[model samples]
Target: MNLSFSKLFFVLAFVFGLFAVMVIAKSVLIPLSMALLVSFILFPVVQKLEAWGVNRLLAAFLSLLMMFLILTGFLTLFSTQIMNFSDQIAGFTGKIMDTLSEVIVYINGNINFIEDLNREELIEEGISWLQASSGTLLQSTFSTTATLFTGIFTTIIFTFLILIYRDGLTKAFVSFGEVENQDRIFRMLQKIQRVGKQYLSGMFILILILGFANSIGLLLIGIDNPFLFGFLAALLSIVPFVGTTIGAVIPVLYAFMSSDSLWVPVAVVIWFWAIQVIESNFLNPKIVGSSLNVNALVAILSLLVGAAVWGVAGMILFLPFASILKVICEEFDQLKPIAMLISNDISGDEKKAAKNSMWIEKVKGWFK
Candidate 1:
């Protein structure tokens, strides 16, 4: 009893300590964690380049350059579109106001009490609140942007160094374990690296597929800036369930504002719905394959926990983190039970088979 109590206490304390560190050290941890995953993903490119007689440092640099160029191109495209749209901000504002008025009228019609609500007074209160919060919001926005850039820069540098010295890092890690355990550690690391590479690549491919599908659907439905809305939604879809809904709102809002026909927004909903179905049923399972192996419930919980700890970064990082943790748990004999508990691979079929086998053995014993 005492031993079990002690173990429970220790485990709870350890979990709390880990969460505290994650919350407190997010600035450093976030960049470092990103760098680790990025390095893992890029390692194969570096390896291939090195096999072609390129110097390790040069290969790593080339890999980084390729990534930077692709990123720059995407950012340039998004920014240019945003700047062009900004030129018509006044028009958009008017449309927004009109939409809000329509919504207010619709609601007031449905509710007698709401008919007494003064729209002008509500608008005035909202404007006053915005004015009060504007300075703080602006400051926060600036700080967040600066931190984001800093984190990206730091991640790039760390990823480069990691790629260059990956062999040394592996050797150093292996040296910490006993000689017999060193091989197991190396195997564990390899599994982790494979999972990281496959997972990241799959995510990238999934995003592109979603973006293409969404853009095509929107274009067919006559939504303007289809690519912009589609790609933005694809990016948000990285956050799991809430992200797709959030992304869908942009095109839906545009449809509501720009179209005289009521069917436009309804079409927008159908388009997103179809894409979501395809993505959930087909693209994810086929492209991502068995790399993540995190079930939906656990994945959602991890996203929630990660968001609570590190906001958006947590949501992005936690899935891969869970994968690595599962690998570690499986590698250690004492932790096998934990691995089973967390693994999505322990599916219904496997459990059913195990139960059937147990029943067969019990029947056989009775016959004997």
Candidate 2:
């Protein structure tokens, strides 16, 4: 019993230490994680090129080139849409301020507790605040944009290298384990690679399907930039639960701003909500079902922890990490219980018995 306690303590301490390292080294780690996932996705392409009599380095380069072209196309489209959105924002600023002034005046008129407030003075003060903050906002935006580009550049480099040296890496990993364990390790690695590849490919198909579905809905509702808004929302849905809401809010808010009728924005909201339902019910289950297989509660907690540790990149990276962990846990006899706890497969009586035993042990320990 004492041995078990010590082992549990060691496990918990290791997990905490690992999280601390991830948080501290996120600048480097996040890019490497991104690259690792990308390498999995591109591995097949590299293999196919090599099978066609291409040299190893050339095959890796070709795969990277293909990825670069796809990214370039996506960025070109997004940048064009963003420039248009910025132009609209620039044109609408005066109207937005006017609307804000009216709102402040209306609120002041309705509330007797805030009788000290002057509408014109409030408007003047608000504008002054905006002007003062604009410089700081711009500076931060530039800084963030630079960091984003740097991360992308590093990820691209790392991905190419990983593709070029994947076999060597696999051999290195296998060499560290026992000879009898080597086969198991190789099998685990293959499963991990397969999961990574399938998860990404499934996500891409889901995005395409959801994007099309959303575009149709928005078009039917007569929303401007249907394709752009739809695809953007679909891409954001990659982040899980919160992503759909954030994605939906963007175009809904845009609809409110650009349209004169209240009904247009209302329709926009209803449309996105409906699409979200379809995505949650039909699209995700069909495309990405059981691939990660993480419990909903555990997944949400991981996402929050990831966001706290590495910001947006963490949110994206952690789900796959959870999947990798699940794979690892399943491969080891002693960690089977952990795999069950983190996994979505909780309906079994065996899992229930294990969980109950765990809780009862903790309860018994409290008195000691």
Candidate 2 stretches greater than 4 Å from native: 1-5, 113-116, 346-368
- Global fold similarity of model 1 (TM-score): 0.88
For model 2, name the residue pairs that clash.
Answer: none
lDDT of 2 by residue, 269-341 (tens): 9988888898898878778856878888878887998889998888888888888888998887666666766
Give lDDT: candidate 2, residue 21.
96
Model 2: lowest-lDDT 10 consecutive positions: 359-368
Highest lDDT model number: 2
- Assess the local accuracy of residue 140 in candidate 1 as a C-alpha lDDT between 0 and 100: 100
C-alpha local distance difference test of each model: 0.84, 0.86
What TM-score do all the candidates reach, one by one? 0.88, 0.91
Q: Give the worst 10-residue stretch by lDDT in candidate 1.
A: 359-368
Per-candidate clashes, comma-separated: 0, 0
